[model samples]
Target chain A: MTDNATRDIEELIGMMARLPGLGPRSARRAVLHLIKKRALLMMPLAEAMQQVAATARECLACGNIGTSDICDICSSEKRATGEICVVEDVADLWAMERGASFRGRYHVLGGTLSALDAIGPEELRIPKLLDRVRAEGVTEVILALNATVDGQTTAHYIAEQLEGTGVSVTSLAQGVPIGGELDYLDDGTITAALKARKRF
Target chain B: MTDNATRDIEELIGMMARLPGLGPRSARRAVLHLIKKRALLMMPLAEAMQQVAATARECLACGNIGTSDICDICSSEKRATGEICVVEDVADLWAMERGASFRGRYHVLGGTLSALDAIGPEELRIPKLLDRVRAEGVTEVILALNATVDGQTTAHYIAEQLEGTGVSVTSLAQGVPIGGELDYLDDGTITAALKARKRF
Candidate 1:
């Protein structure tokens, strides 16, 4: 390859390697694939990326990323169930939407309260969430945070903040996951599953 | 997300899922990551893609993709080693370059002969390779195709075509790979390694 061309391609591979799941080797492979299938894959991907770059924005109300000011769930009258499912990030909200079970809207906190990272409740959407619960007449606030130390701490903080707001605060049940083998289950999960065991 | 906003995000995810290694779940994750790090990663990646999309082109002489008419290797005076490494595709050529051992230029065949796929010598760059061998005063042609059945067939065919051309045609040695365990090697590889054993 020419010097400039090699540099461009290498820059692309470098950027690709920085992505979440890709490494240098896989980025090289992906670049080769993109070059070969430029018309079919690369061009469209480039266009899609440009479109997304220009349009994608965080929903003002719930912090969900979309191409609009407010997310669909937040704007939809049908989703006004007076219950807000709070998540750490947009990925969790997307996972919940994929499940297609939750009829309520969501509140994306962006991240948990991490003392090491110096991230507090102000860094997240905690204050905004409180305001929404009070102004929207919310009845339930489901804390669907991960079981990590930071996640639990954030959940507890949120729960405390909503203590006398007339809204019931709850959390996702901790148990052995469905389809997970007992042998692979951690001791904490096994104990939680046993304690929360349901009658057949 | 409004209807249009949801469609736009979904379209981006759908396109991402069509990539070689990514699936729907990981594509969604990638999209979310991109949106979150829009200023840091997404915008730069999008710009890089656009630049590559606009400038990247196939080298006319050796069929290597670059930003110019002739690739650097093909045009470089130092690379006139009278040896041309032949590869099935541009990816293989790039892999060979990454090894940084060969001081010779390369010829990309675009693809190997596959009777099952109705591919023939004319479909590849076999004829162009023969012309280059005679015109460029080439002394050796290394057939670094894959170890698959079609790859071997294509190599044999090229060797026969260059039978009386005064140029030696060779292939990559098939044996136990570096750091590969003998127990993990297949029977065919073991036999080949034994047959081609060298004095250590």
Candidate 2:
């Protein structure tokens, strides 16, 4: 191909390679697929991405992504249950929303504290989370962070920070996952399940 | 989130899920990653897609995708070596390009002829291949299609059609792939490799 078209496509492939799951080879395959289905798939995908880029913004109150400043959950009157579910990132918040189990608002920390990466409470939205607990009269703070070591450490820090504020802190139950078999479960999960045993 | 922003983001995720090799779950992850790095990755990707969509087109002669009516390869004086490598898709053409082994241009058939899928010679760019072979003084037509049943069948059909064109018809050599172990290879591959053994 001419250098112009070739360079443009190569640049796109380079950018696509930066996505989480895609590597250089898969990115090339995807770009070719998109070019082949340009009318049906490529154009629509581009338009959708443009629309989202133009509209989507991070929520100022809880750090959840939304089109508006406060986010839907933060603004909804019914969601004001005096409870805030703290998560490491907006993906976790979306996952919780998909489950449709929790009715409370959320606090997205953006990332867990990582001393290796030089991240601290000031780097995350920890101060804003504390402000929400006091200003919004939050009675409960749910630690919905991941089970990683950094996640646990950040959760503990947040719980300790809210200790004197009178708001009760809790975490999602840890145990064998649903549909999990003991044979396939990891040792940590098995131990957690045994420790948290309950009656049927 | 409010339905407006939720719907917009959901729509983008849905469109992303349509891409090749990406399923619903990975699509969501990719979308969330894009949003998190909106300024750095997402907006640039959108712009790149737009630029490609505006310029990329199918080469009229060889069916190769390019930014112009005739691809750079077709227009290049150096690539007019009286040889054409035939492949089933643009992905295959790209794979060959990455290898940098072939000096001639290529003919992308788009897909193999499939009886079950009702794909015939007319469905692919077979007629275009014949036209190029005759008009461009092509001497050697190399079938570099996959070794699948459909691929071989289509290759045979193309060979039959070009029988009287005075053009030499050949196919890619089949042998033990590089780094492939005899213990791990299938019976058919072993048989093909054994039959096609060359001078040591």
Candidate 3:
């Protein structure tokens, strides 16, 4: 066949194959589904994607993603509980949000401190988080880091850094394992962690 | 906090909530995931989505999605094996391709002839398929439609229509159940169905 009309589909499948759980076969099926449901699903999805592409930006102050510099949690006066819940990434932050009880603001660390991967605190938003804690008068800094070795190490380091800052440093409870992440943990685990919080 | 950012995120959540199998909770998590993986996954996905959004079009011949009028299968002389395997949709055609056994051309019927849904043969690509069978000198017309009641009904109608065309009418076999879709069935089911070989 002349290779003209198939290019778009081929390209779509190529990119979709790169998704977390999708392979080339699944990608092809998904592409076909989107096209068939073009007017209802695909067209709206395309429009939403385009709008998000154009407008999406990371919250400059707290690392939360929004179309603004300061996210709602960071700016909301009601959210200031003198506590900042630190998380590894935005997904964790979203998970916490689903619990619907944590009225405190969030501090997205972006990632953990990993020497093996050569990732340092500087590479993450650690400095930014520290700055927020100090400027926002955060009294309690809750390290909701993953239970991984790197996560614990990062938590310890942060607690040490804020040793003399008059802030109560604490970490989530031990329900999450040595290598467990909040994303994988259910809502109950997260809630229990928040309730049975311990001093670092 | 200003309403713009909150509105934006709410809008995003609303859009994401509309996706198949994804609720408001999953949408929030997914959006957060996309943001965190912005560099590695989101940006490329966005770019690809943009390109696809601009270029995607339906194949005029077989109703398969493509950027051109006639699809790759219809335009290629190698695919015209004097046999046309008719499927309920492009997804079925794709499943057949994954098997890599069928070397003949395909005719995507778009959907089954659903009387309950008021879907007629005209709504599907039945007319186009008949035209292809005649114009391409097809000797064997394989009814690869799904094993649903409507699918069988459509297949019977097609077989009856081609009765005087001197073409041998056959089906994928009884391995496919009364309401089973070829897409959801495994490769083994497809292989068995193809192997059993029975006259329609």
Best by lDDT: 2
How many clashes show up per model? 2, 0, 0
lDDT of 1 by residue, A118-162 (tens): 999899999999989989989999999989999999999999999
- Tens-digit per-residue lDDT, B116-183, candidate 3: 89999899888888887788789999999887788889999999989898999999866787799988
Q: How accurate is candidate 3 locally (lDDT)?
A: 0.77
- What is the C-alpha lDDT profile of model 2 across B1-200, one tens digit per residue? 55577898898888878777788888888998999888899999998998898889999988888888989888998999999999999889988988988999899999999999999999999999999998999999999999999999999999999999899999999988899899999999999988988899
CAPRI level of candidate 1: medium
Name the docking class for model 2.
Answer: medium
Report DockQ per prediction, comma-separated: 0.55, 0.70, 0.29
In model 1, which runs have C-alpha deviations exceeding 4 angstroms? Answer: A115-118, A147-150, A173-194, B174-191
Chain B TM-score per candidate, please. 0.95, 0.98, 0.80
Candidate with better TM-score, 1 vs 2: 2
Interface RMSD values, listed in order for every candidate: 1.6, 1.3, 3.4
> Candidate 1 chain A: worst 10 consecutive residues by lDDT?
A65-74
Runs of candidate 2 with Cα error greater than 4 angstroms are: B179-184
Q: Which portions of model 3 show Cα errors greater than 4 Å?
A: A146-153, A172-200, B1-6, B13-30, B36-55, B95-103, B113-123, B134-136, B146-164, B172-200
The most accurate candidate by DockQ is 2
